[model samples]
Target: MVIPVLAIVFTLYFFSTILNSPWTAQVSAFSLGSLLLLFCVIFVAKTVYQLRRGDGTLSFGNIVSRDDLASGRVGLFLATLGFTLLIDYLGFTLTTFLFLLVSMTILARGRGFMRITLVSALMALGGWAVFILAFDTRFPRGWFETTMKAVLANG
Candidate 1:
């Protein structure tokens, strides 16, 4: 319920901002926003009908709770924030590897660290190779990437 409301508001603001852009530049945003708004309207109507029928009630405690934040979710959120902020400095592959390793360690409760690290490293390297090498997608080159290139060149 709260998610849909936020999505509707976000879509409206996004549309407003993109309105001045050229058609080609705004087409994807316009299309996606239109669909989002349409679904939101339908959801709103259904939710209102359910409330009038006493079938559903909004509970702020359930929707946005301090307990959720207290239960290590805040740490996960902070971890994600850190990942996003440090990505340009760490580069995609290394950042993703560290993020996955940390998140798994946090959530896995007594899981073996070395096993998790190995798995994370394999997945991260595979993803980086696929996207950066095979597909030729461009990701930010930070200190790690630069050093790897230098080592490879020197070898």
Candidate 2:
């Protein structure tokens, strides 16, 4: 019920933005897609909670009490969004590596720092190498591109 309302509102908002703003259709589509995905998750979570409770209503006590809990994923998501913006300014290889490292660190609880670091680095480096070398795809040239170009010039 609430999810449907929010979804309608978000759709209207996006439609208005597309009509009024100078942003390209792709950008508006992406924004609307994200909003729709968020609503889907919200709907799913609510449904799951209701099913788990065996009641359609979540208790007021549960909502008032558990609202204080800080979900760590919120911070991780904000970091990822920032990293995405950084990609336009810092390039894909560097941003992807840094974003993956930070997100993995945050999500890896009770894990050894050394192990996490090694795994994150290996994954990030291997992904970038494959995309750049094998696929021959061009990524954004961010702030680090000049330095990368210099290094690759020598290689």
For all candidates in order, the CA lDDT equals 0.83, 0.69
State which candidate has the highest lDDT: 1
lDDT value, residue 87 of candidate 2: 88
Query: How well is each residue in 7-118 modelled by candidate 1, as lDDT tens digits?
Result: 9989989888878899987999988889999999999999999999999997888755897665657667777998999898899889989888887777665379999999
TM value for model 2: 0.56
Q: Output the lDDT of residue 2, model 2.
A: 56
- Give me the runs in candidate 2 sitting further than 4 Å from their true place: 10-71, 143-145
TM-score for all models, in order of appearance: 0.61, 0.56
